[model samples]
Target: MTATIHRLGRDQAPSLEPMMALVAEDMNSVNAVILDRMQSRIPLIPELAGHLIAGGGKRMRPMLTLASARLLDYSGTRHHKLSAAVEFIHTATLLHDDVVDGSGLRRGRKTANIIWGNSASVLVGDFLFSRSFELMVEDGSLKVLKILSNASAVIAEGEVNQLTAQRRIDTDEEQYLEIIGAKTAALFAAACRIAAVVAERDEKQEQALDAYGRNLGIAFQLVDDALDYESDGATMGKDAGDDFRDGKVTLPVILAYARGSADDRAFWKAAISGHRISDEDLTHATGLLRSTGAIADTLARARHYGQRAIDALGMFGNGKAKAALIEAVEFAIARAY
Candidate 1:
């Protein structure tokens, strides 16, 4: 609760330059293919999918798909299909997450649940989830299907576990990692893994990509948690202190509480456990995080994961694509709101 959101000024993070270039290189064709594949058997399905698809996400997942494939020297067009598949899976989860969390806003706009209702959001999410499977099966690659299915299952199970464990002060970093891995990292892993799989990469290269994605996902979510404390809804596209408001425990607050003075720790116990965070108390908590360096420590951990993600690609040879992937690791941690 002590974490203060940090919004970036006009200076954009330099790390994104290479990744942005890669995105521009292939984004148009990739998006075209993705849009073409979104045609649904059910009319409402397309509408629901369209609502989420048009919401203007970073398209980070699909970009990773293309980048990975290109890095492995895949000149074929099948990567576009796999990229769309990865996007569908990601969008499906967002729909379901909004519904489960009862969140009203995402990315500074009304959530699907707010516009279409939870029932619609949940059902449409199911539709998208099924559609992703159908698309992958059409590709007729057993490896792709297996990897994506496993990721899907883990994402669902992770959300369920997080729901059950909400607001528990005792949640450790291990438990935190497990929950985020399933909920966030699984698709990142799958997206990267599928690229190597489709390219028929060697085992060592495949493993490297997997490690990169897994560590990148962890770093991404950790930074996400940090931003929740420091960013406003307009900038971050979500409510500030959303985790705290939802009675969820995240890293900054966890670290702060662990290192706080008796009274500072008691404030968290009372505010979180007894449900007593007021506007006044929120200001006090932010100050505590600044004073205690909990935010800095959590950011340091995210930096470590970010570096690991870059290091995972050391085995790969030189190329703009590989450099872009490496730059993405830095971008993941350094993004400002």
Candidate 2:
């Protein structure tokens, strides 16, 4: 079979700055809430949390919450707290993930676990998780509480599911989708749906936004998976080939393993079987991904999900927020470039 290489042209992919600009004012409010809620009398609590929070991520999840609220013309303060809560939940997951993965870098900086030790990182993660619940309670809406709280639980389940799939060469597309959906996309769905809920919108609108966020999150993770093979560490904000080293069975690996030649399959099976992966092994793995169209196929799946995310916004009327949300889908897929 011939490989179909996917190339990202410069003009085709727009920057994420516009999405951030569209919701700039609201994101500012979300940031304020994040800083305020992260504070505590104990210096270490704030210190550890701030370390990761300050290590600038795109803040995509919280921005989705803000933009989703704006899409529905929600003129309330409650979404602010909820957005911060979403961010806290995301950050808590990152802390725990670093510990689980034994990762030393995040967002191009030292991971909290590396700087503060695994014990502090784990404890701080728990603190942030509790802090997220506190924000939910402060919102005083049982419905909103249910959505976000359920998302947190789903995120945990996804992580465990991925752990179960780790280093297993036989992991397939369905299992990979389940892992990303639970680990990453669940919160995205909740973040967007809660906006419609706060606005007192009907169930249809809530479901639409939920669909949008869920598909976008899936696309986002697919791109990350591909980027692990294709990107330099600078672009990915983590070590290049981190997934290969960790024996994580992401979509790229699944597709490559399924399509590879006999020798190629053997190489992959050994590389990801929890053995010591040399630099040369990673180089060969990347070559197979490129030559077998795994990266392209993975990116095609991302674009598929991105289009679904855009389609989910059809119920909403035309406005800057709506347009920006659509562009956000483009940005999510384009990030791999």
What is the C-alpha lDDT profile of model 2 across 1-337, one tens digit per residue?
A: 5543223233656667767987899888989999998999989999999999988888989899888988988888888888999999999999999999999888999999998999999999999999999999988999999998899889999999999999999999999999999999999999999999999999999999999999999999999999999998788889999999999999999999999999988988999995649988889899999998999999999999988898888778778888788878888888876
Q: Cα lDDT of model 2 overall?
A: 0.90
- Give the lDDT of residue 86 in candidate 1: 85
**All candidates' TM-scores?**
0.92, 0.96
Model 1 lDDT at residue 304: 82
Clashes of each: 6, 0
lDDT of 1: 0.80
Q: Which residues of candidate 1, in runs, are more than 4 Å off?
A: 1-12, 15-17, 23-25, 41-43
Per-residue lDDT of candidate 1, residues 85-195 (tens digit) = 889899989998998888988878888888878888888887777777888888889989998999999999999988876877777788888998899988897889888
TM-score of 1: 0.92
Error of 2 at 240 (Å): 0.7
Window of ten residues with lowest summed lDDT in model 2: 1-10
Q: In model 1, what are the clashing residue pairs, if there are any?
A: 4-230, 5-229, 5-230, 5-231, 6-230, 108-237
Candidate 2, residue 195: the lDDT equals 94
User: Against the correct fold, how does model 2 do in TM-score?
Assistant: 0.96
